[model samples]
Target: MKRFVGLISGGKDSFYTIELLKQKEYNLVALVYIKSTDIDSYMYQTVGHEMIPFYRQVLDVPIYIIETNRKAINTDKEYVHTLNDEVEVIYDHLYELQKKAVFECVSVGAIKSYYQYNRIKSVCDRLNLSVLTPLFNLDQRVIYDAIIECMDVVIVKVACTNLGKEIVGKNLNVISGMRVDNWCGEGGEYETAVLDAPFFKKKLRIKNYEVLHHPEEEDKERTVFFMKINEIEVLEK
Candidate 1:
C-alpha cells in the first residue's frame, strides 16, 4: 500500500480533503498539524491554537505538530520568503514520522487560495512528494454541506467582525442558510474542530463550555467570542 501524510487544520476543508482521499484509497499514515504560534501568526488559514489536540484525539491519528512561528513579516513577498524557513522546520519533523522512506504525498486543505496551495506544492517539490488537495476545485457550498452531513463539528473561535458572538457552543447545523453564507463556513471567517464523526470508534462529548467575548474598545469595532472549552469528555461507544 502507498503511504501518505495528511495535513489537518481541524476545519471543514481539511476534513473534507481527508474524506475524499480515503475514498480514493490512499493509505493515510499520520496527521500533520501546523500548531498556531499566536493569534497574529499566519494561522495557515486556521483559527486558534488550542483546537489541535482535540482534533488528534477524535481522529485517533498520531499527530505531528510543527511550530511554524517565526518573526513577523507582513507583505505577500515577505510572507513567501519566510515560508521557506518555516517549511524547513516542518520538513525536519516530517522526516521523523517515517524515517525510512519519507511520505509519498503531503495532503493539504487548500481550496481557492492559489497562494496557499502553491506554497504547499513548492514544499512538496522540495521534499520530493506529491501534494494532494482533494477539495481543490470543488465548490465551497458543496464542501460545507458535506461536512455538516458527514461530521459532528463545533464552532470554537470567530474573528471579531462577523457572527462571532452568537456562534459559541452552537453546532454547525443551527446555522444552515444565509447565516452560513454570511460566515463563509468553508473559508477562514471562523474556525472549528471536530468532536465526533461517523469514522470514529467512539464519539466525543464536550462539557463546561464558556462563551468569551473580546470586545474591541478603541474604535467601536465588532466584538468576537470564543467558545472556551473548560472541560471535555470522550466517551466509549
Candidate 2:
C-alpha cells in the first residue's frame, strides 16, 4: 500500500475524500491540518476547526497541526493560482513528513475552487509530492448523497442567505439533499463538522454546543453563523 498524507479539516468533504482513498487501499500514515488563526483563508477552511482534536482522538492517528496563519498577506481579492506565503508553510509540514517517512501523495478535498485546487497542486509540485483531489468538480448532489450515506456530520457554519442558524448543529440532511442552490455547503456558502466517519473508531455525540451568529457590526449581505463546540462524547457503533 502507498503511504500518503491527507490534508484534513473536520468537514464533510475532507472526511469523505479520506475514506474514499482508504477504500482504494491507501495507507494514510498521518493527517495534516493548518491552524489558521485568520478566518479569511483563500485555500483552507477556518470555521469550526475546534473539533479537530476530537477527530484525531477518533481516528487514532498522528496529526501534525501546522500553524499556517499569515495575516499580512492574502489581502487581495484577486485569487492567484500559485503558492503564496501561506502554502509554503503547508509545504514545510509535508516536507517534514517526507523526511520522517516516504510518502507519495498529499490528498485534498477541493470541489470547485480552481484557485484552491491549483494552489495546493502547485505547492505539492514543489516538493515532488503528488496532489490527490478526489472531490474535484463533482456534482454537489452526488457528493452530498455519498457523504450523508457514510459520514455523520453537522453544520457548524452558515455564510449564505439561504442558510440559517436553525441548520447549524443539525444533521447535513437538514438542508434538503436535492436542493442544488446550496448543497454540500461548497464555495463558502456553509461549512460542516464531521462527527462520525467510517474510518472513525467511534461516533461523536454532541453533548453541548452553542450557535453564534457573526457580530452585527461585521454583518454582510448575508448572515453567517458558527456552532461553538462546547462538548462532544464518543460512542461505539
Global CA lDDT of candidate 2, please?
A: 0.78
Off by over 4 Å in 1: 45-48, 55-57, 71-88, 98-102, 160-162, 179-187, 214-219
Which candidate number maximizes TM-score? 2
- Distance from true location, Cα of 38 in model 1, Å: 1.7
**Model 2 per-residue lDDT tens digits across residues 80-140:** 4335467667777777778897789988888887766776776788789888888898998
RMSD of 1: 3.1
* Model 2 CA deviation exceeding 4 Å by range: 72-84, 177-179, 216-222
- Residue 210's lDDT within candidate 2 is 90
**Ten consecutive residues with minimal summed lDDT in candidate 1?**
72-81
> How far in Å is the alpha carbon of 199 misplaced in model 1?
2.5
